[model samples]
Target: MRSGPTAEPHGDTAEGDTAGRAGALRPRRRLLVLASTFPARPDDGVPAFVLDLARHEAEEFDTVVLTPRVPGAAADEVVDGVRVVRYPYFPRRFEDLADGAILDNLRARRSRVLQVPALLAAQYLAVRRAVRTGGPDVVHAHWTVPQALVATLAAPRVPMVVTTHGGDVYALRAAPLVQLKRWVLRRAAHVTTVNGEMRERLTAWGVPESGTSVVPMGVEPGPAAAARARTARVPGRIVAVGRLVEKKGFAVLLDALRRIDDVPWEVVVVGDGPLRAGLGRRAAGLPVTFAGQLGKDEVLDALASATVVAMPSVPASNGDQEGLPVTLLEAAAVGAAVVASDLPGIRDVVHHDVSGLLVPPGDVDALAAALRRALTDRDGRERWQAGAGRAAEPYTGDRIGARYRAVLRAAAGQHPD
Candidate 1:
């Protein structure tokens, strides 16, 4: 079968030719991407997930993105060929009996609480804008909760696809939330997830099997990626990517680092989050160095410079988990051997003893041993690196983009009976 985005290849030639020629002769499908989280700054990786789809699909489609605008986001702009429109939100505020703003001693917590309504309103406004703009063949939502809810409202008049990344479904399975999620899933023309676990969860939650699809996330190797891989020299540098959070298991990795006393490898942690200060404190007086947050090129360079990539992910306290971290794919695509925790999403990305090695989640000794083996054994490292690079091929933006095109086309009711 012809892959990528080709015209209705199996349908009637005359009818097919008309739409195909129309699409190719001028512009292709108009795609609207919906998401609650998008890149607000240069160093952010959140939008890269959605952007990869837009960039690859742009080959056969024109793309527009609707994202929630916070205080920091640009109202409108184009990034990497994707047109982004951000909408502002006004939050509900609580007031005391005196009609003054309820005084909360922990001002930060109060502000965080107040921001939820605004975020939700912005997402709803994004959906209204997409529906009003009126050109996309389909609306693709990046997460299940707010975006899915918005898509559900917009789908009665237009086709829509919902993608469940980690938090969308997993983090909000409680009473009313679960009910709401079910309603949205029922309304979606199609649903997609990057891992088996998420697919299973959605199916169990009452989403029809036919409507659910498993399309792993993908990466686009930069021009220098292959050349850098060919000339990789182990600097005894160990690297970890992703936001500094418990599920990422930076603390567990820190404990593992303490166990490997004799190894001279220097640990370089990239990405930032709420847990940075705590994680930094945990690594105090050790060989660990926090690179804070870094840009895409710098992260790739960090992976290239490392002897091994350590991803000690675990299920978070709230049951939130990784949904195939793109960092793992990026590291592997650049030919770096990886040692990842054997968690659901992480395991899906890093195969044990194949692309890379897997160790028990939160086991300091096991992680340390895997790190040591990756760093010390040259032949083992080479085998793992080659396997990692090959494994990364399926997750590349081109391959993954093809899946998106297929799913969206099918979801849009464009396919013939």
Candidate 2:
């Protein structure tokens, strides 16, 4: 947690730094963040980072968020002290379409050929409007396409930073529409990834190493786990949080649960996604309870009430993975024991047998055995809970907010007036 060299605003040192690197800038700055999918209609967790940024950034910078409205979602206003402007977007019905069949499928593969132009125009228009209204000093866009393209096109004179989350970096690069995303990245003043793995991936894909920053999504202080520790019986309740996707390794967790027939456990998975029904079928006859999706408070409540939080995350067959599930950090913050897969981003957050237990990726028996051990060993659980809670201290939203502030300062320095 050593803070990097203190940002030096102005002069040659500021010429190529991220806005967050410019500490000596004018006291207050205006920032506009463009995200493809932000929290909309209260159930969305996609823009959780934006919400955290706005909350903490408001202390110093004037902030506004421009997010696309998924067809049926409500148009926006301010939520939790952040100014949210949702723009019109086409309904995406085939997001879950399987790879097969028809001329429509072929058209859909080339669909981005059409979708990209429309998205760029809409996002550029929205950014232009925000500039007129707020006179933002920098434009920060999340995800590769549209945000990067729109920000570049609409606010070329304004310094801009683009962040590449999992999808854009891992899935979209080689896609048919990748050239546009590549163009957008090339034009961005700075590019960031949530973890080191992504930074390396993007660099390999041709983004300059100097322009990339690794800034993970931060965790918030959750309910204390010690309060729950007072109770004697544990391993009775288990919790899992994340969208119900193949990459999350939900099926593997189910397989683990089936192997441990003697352990009396009840699982509460707290998120929704396309695989819900498929997972529901796979979980048949197990002591599982799918909570569908829950609010942040609700998910934390589940973690606070649980004995062990299992995060059996694994890199998907197609190479998709997590950038450190904030859920694990939240569980640790609340004093719950963590048992997760040892994978790229996860390895950065979880030290096997130190902060939490780490099992091999996709090993159901290992996951189940770890869970059983964590449940029965009160002393071991207490040790991990205390140590893990302390380990999570640096990841809290407040701490992360401060880190992002530093990054923005650096990014702004790259293009000082």
Please write out the lDDT profile of model 1 over residues 1-417, one tens digit for every residue: 012243332233443444465454433567788866556766554336777677766655567888755455577887776778876665323311111111111122445555565556666766776667656778888887667787676546677888887867667657898889989888888999978888998889899998898886788876338536555555788999987666789999998888887768899999776687888889899888888777777778788888888999987776777888888888888888899988777776677888789999889889889988888888888888898888887787767876787777677655523
- Provide the TM-score for each candidate, comma-separated: 0.87, 0.81
lDDT of 2 at 306: 83
Which residue runs does candidate 2 get wrong by more than 4 Å?
Answer: 1-27, 41-47, 70-76, 91-120, 173-182, 222-234, 414-417
lDDT by residue (tens digit), candidate 2, 147-229:
77778878888888887767666554356666777777878778878779888877776889998888777776633444344
- Model 2 is weakest, by summed lDDT over 10 consecutive residues, at 95-104
Residue 191, model 2: Cα distance from true site in angstroms: 2.4
Q: Residue 371 in model 1: shift from native, Å?
A: 1.5
Q: Which candidate is the best by TM-score?
A: 1
**Candidate 1 stretches greater than 4 Å from native:** 1-27, 41-47, 70-73, 91-110, 223-232
lDDT of each: 0.73, 0.70
